[model samples]
Target: MKVTFPHMGNMSIVIKALLKELNIEFIPPPPITKRTLSLGVQHAPESACLPLKINIGNFLEAAEKGADTVLMAGGIGPCRFGYYNQVQREILNDLGVNLNMIVLEPPDNHIGELLKRLRTLTGSNSWWRVVKAIRFAFAKCEALDDLERAASRIRCRELQRGDVDRVYAQGCQAIDQATTPKEIVQCRDEYLTKMRSLPLDHLKRPIRIGIVGEIYTLLEPSSNGFMEKNLGRLGAEVSRSIYLSEWVNEHLLKGLLPVKGHKLTRKRAQPYLNCMVGGHGQESIGATIEYAQQGYDGVIQVGPLTCMPEIVAQSIMPNVEKDFHIPVLTIYVDEQTGEAGLMTRLEAFVDMLERRKRIQVESGLQG
Candidate 1:
């Protein structure tokens, strides 16, 4: 079966690695662009969330390219993400697209079911081979995450405009090309070294911002108007709470391995939000608290217009702001979101942050 999946930041790269090792044919959807968004907006229900619309667009495009099987992740939460697969399946079927859709649910307590689903894709591949492929793919995933983290740091301070972007583009290409674990490690290190070598202003302490929101909007640059890159270009260091590797470690690997921080996240979120309000709502509150405790300059929350989880998080943010004294900007985005408007809001927020920092410094000096 020629398998296809929707794009979620660097997730496509990891999926490509996994499918390649499984010896399965993969038909990746075209890079997201205006056309993709337009197609999604044109067909999706008026009230559907942004991610669902984009995903529908992705599957439609992939189906046109002869993908017979679609692989989608399933969720178990009050968030609508839990119903995406069934909803999209109905949508595609109504549009007369004939494709086998597989939804891989999180293996919270059903590891065997998850393994069975995986085996269906691998076909005749031996158990050991499947294990090796998974390990290799995860290795690539970790490497990609490391490179991205470095890029965020380098982007703000690079002496040459776009140098970090250029190197990062090349690094993604290099990582995509590497097939072996050793090659992946080598490529990652080389890119890390290159990023470090880029001429940077040693004395420029950039405004540091933490990004927390719904997973899809937080991770997908196109969905969020490339906010991380834009923040860096505007001379701010951006740290996101969600990374694909970390998600995998927490959701998929936690059953097999002992993973930390989930409890800590819940504990930190206790004051403002004590329970899982569905989706990443609790995580958003927890991450914002963590960032505030870590003394970040500000936090930006981005999510689809109707995302319930983020809506819940957004309502609680005012209390978070008051208690933590960290400025928080919540941007609700959708197909109608305009770049110009987003840029203006971002610029004003950055200016405010800079003024706040300067005022604090002056007050300290006077004291």
Candidate 2:
């Protein structure tokens, strides 16, 4: 089976590792670009969210490169994501692209079914082999997340602009090339060392900003207009609430290995949003509260326009700001969102945070 999956940030790296270990022939979709967005927009429904359109675009591109089987994750919440695979299948069929589609539902609810699907695709009924492949994939995902978190910090303090980014790109290439667990660990360590070696302004107190929003848009740079990199360029250290490894742990592993701060996230989110309102709405509220409590200077919420869950979260953010006394910025992006406009707003937000910090310090001195 020649399989393909949509790109969600560095998730492709994890997926590639899994497919390779399973001995599955696969076609990796090209990175999302203007051409991909254009193709997706041309065919998708006018009101579909940005992620769905981009996914359709990715599938179309993969189909062109002879991918006959598609693998997509499924959700079981109030989010519309559970239906994406079905919708995309119909869309591709209408476009005269015949392909096999498999949706891997949350393991909590469909582990047996998921495994059956995997066995079908890989033609391997060996449960042990499948388990080994999954463990390897999860390990790589953790390594990628660690590297990304380190890069975010290094980006803010790097004395030489673009040095961290250059090394990061090279590190990603190294991780992608490495095929075994030991190789992945070595690649991660080598990249971490290089990132640490970069000259940094140790005395500089950079503003820290927490990013929270829909999982897809928040994680995928192309979908969200590369907001994290833009924040770092504007002198803010960015921390995101969602990561592929975290999602796998929470949903697929069913919390067998508890994520640090998972309990605190639910606790902080209790006052404003006590329940999951679908998607990552509850997590966004919880993360913003945690960031505020941790003394972050600001928080930014990003999602596609008209996304129901983020819209729900956005409505509650003003109260969070009032209670926490931390600034919050909400950005809704669609296909037409301009990078220039995004950069301008980010600059304004960072400036506001900087000024607030100065005022607080001055008041402290006066007291």
Per-prediction tally of clashes: 0, 0
> TM-scores of the models, in the given order?
0.97, 0.97
Tens digits of lDDT, candidate 1, 106-216: 877766667788877889998889888888888888888889988887688988899998999899889999989999999999999998898988789888899999889
Model 1: colliding residue pairs: none
lDDT of 2 by residue, 107-216 (tens): 65656756776777768447888888888988888888888998887688988889888888888888988888999999999999999988988788999999999889
RMSD of each: 1.3, 1.4
Candidate 2 lDDT at 46 equals: 80
Clashing pairs in 2: none
The deviation in Å at residue 153 for candidate 1 is 1.8
Worst 10 residues of 2 by lDDT: 254-263
lDDT of 1: 0.88
Query: Predicted candidate 1: what Cα RMSD to the true structure?
Result: 1.3
